[model samples]
Target: MKASNGTTQDVGGRRKNSKREDESGRLGEYGQDSSVNGTKQIGATSADSSGENIIRTSVTWDGRSDAGKILEEVLLLKQQFLDYVKSHQGRLEARLDESKKQEQKFLANAEGLELRLRKALTIQQTKDESDNTEEPE
Candidate 1:
């Protein structure tokens, strides 16, 4: 029921002591000293408790190096994609125009057939009227 740090725990291994304090007045359960060989503390700044100094460094990439080559390739790929899209669009437009032309040709043929049918019907009617009038002879 008691941990090595003198904190009382429950039967289910849950900590019962809510205010266990360490030497620095920090909670012993949460603020255990995470120092390596008591020299540098984890998540601490560049200074230690005994005034020990630590150096930090940063890294950067030059734009005129590999980064520039990658950017050029990316731009070329983007241009290629744009060209492909434009080519497809032009082909689609041409196909659309061709379809419209075909539809117009079909419509013209339908109108011509309708007109011929009307003329043939009129001629037949006229012939029937003449035949009926000549029946008295």
Candidate 2:
């Protein structure tokens, strides 16, 4: 049996390893160098999260193997994603504030218009009553 390098040979010198690559880095024994590989894998999820696979990898603080380097890249990507989410949240809050301001202004204008209309109606009614009370010649 060949190693898990995704390669296999047959009797006729033919490669018969037809399998899709597992992106989860499932290269058999991974905890062989936990002490010397000062690394960690951190992941968080939410209620609406999908995908049961654990997003994990080994991160090397000082010096590690190729797998450690790959894990480091993953950590960097996670940080970048968090930064992007924070930035988006800030923008959304700003937009919400602007919308509230606009709504308040519209309500104030509407109230002023309503007051003016009520005053005009009251004046018109007073004029009509005075005309009816005047004595005719």
Give the candidate number with the greatest lDDT: 1
TM-score for all predictions?
0.49, 0.49
Give model 2's TM-score versus the native structure: 0.49
Which ranges of candidate 2 are over 4 A from the true structure? Answer: 1-65, 135-137
Which tens-of-lDDT digit does each residue in 57-126 have in candidate 2?
Answer: 2233445457777889999999999999999999999999999999999999999999999999999999
Worst 10 residues of 2 by lDDT: 53-62
lDDT, model 1 = 0.79
Tens-digit lDDT string for candidate 1 (77-122): 9999999999999999999999999999999999999999999999
lDDT of all the models against the reference? 0.79, 0.75
